[model samples]
Target: MDGTPAAEIVSEVAPRAGETIVTHQRVTGFHASSLDVLLRGAGIDTVIIAGVATNLSVEGTARAASDLGYRTIVVSDGCSAGSEAAHSASLESLGLLAEIATADELLTAVHTPATV
Candidate 1:
């Protein structure tokens, strides 16, 4: 599955220079992968999750990250489920464990400078 078409990252969001890419075969990136170790090494305490299968892979990874004591944030508009109902339900449930924000809100927060 490594070199398969489905596994390829689209050009629109391809990794840029100086970006670290971690590949995981498990449902959650943190499982059976160096993602957790890499994050810890980088001293990153926050995680922003966004991907397909809002009720499955997305939710699973977010839950795992939260359980690992990371401040997890899922971008609502950045994920999608099989159905709108499913997506909404997953988002609601995830809200209890993680902060759910729209893509615009996330962008604003990312671009905003931190005040001392």
Candidate 2:
């Protein structure tokens, strides 16, 4: 995503079809044009986020997603942090703002819908 060239950070996770990769220009927000357009055009109602730098990118996008009225879910285990303290802090904050769940929990919830 970074114009500097797709670094190992991204190369390590090769995207499959039907997935769009948008690079963030900065840490303050989702300032990338491609990201905004793709998200909006795709009609993404919810964002199940999982990535590195838990206290940075993950947190930033999570906040932005919540503000955009998306049902955001942070996968606690799927994300990593520079430190355990930072990781825990990010999870706590996300729990206050969005639905924080484990990978297995999310998978189960997605596969099974609740009855009215």
Candidate 3:
């Protein structure tokens, strides 16, 4: 989630179990303190991103993840946008700059490990 409202919604629908949910105040980047702390603490090397506003929060986080030297994967099908053009453009951009895959592909990669 990008902000408190979205985070609240996610919490209402499915409370975060052991995973940490970091809320960024703006879309400038993914330099959130909570996120950095969580990722480092959890020893997370790869970030599989999926969420609404594909061109906004999702892209921001993916790009930041890349900058942070983490293996970033954008789940194309698991994300959406207000318009098809925006969504498609976001996917294309991420594919060109980072790893792009569907949710199933990510699952398989995680499960098999060698397939990645």
Give each model's whole-structure lDDT.
Answer: 0.95, 0.81, 0.80
- Per-candidate TM-scores read 0.94, 0.82, 0.79
Worst 10 residues of 2 by lDDT: 1-10
List the candidate 1 regions with Cα displacement exceeding 4 Å.
none
lDDT tens digits by residue: candidate 2, 17-104: 7776666667524655466567778887888889878999889888888887878899999998999999999899888888999999
Per-residue lDDT for 67 in model 1?
96
lDDT of 3 by residue, 59-107 (tens): 9888888888889888999889999999999899988768989989877
**Candidate number that wins on TM-score, 2 or 3:** 2
Instruction: Give candidate 2's error at residue 105 in angstroms.
Output: 0.4
TM-score between model 2 and native: 0.82
Candidate 1 residue-wise lDDT at 54: 96
The model with the greater lDDT, 1 or 3, is: 1
Best of the candidates, TM-score: 1
Which run of 10 residues does model 1 get worst, by summed lDDT?
20-29
The order by descending TM-score is 1, 2, 3
Error of 3 at 25 (Å): 1.3
Model 2 steric clash total: 0
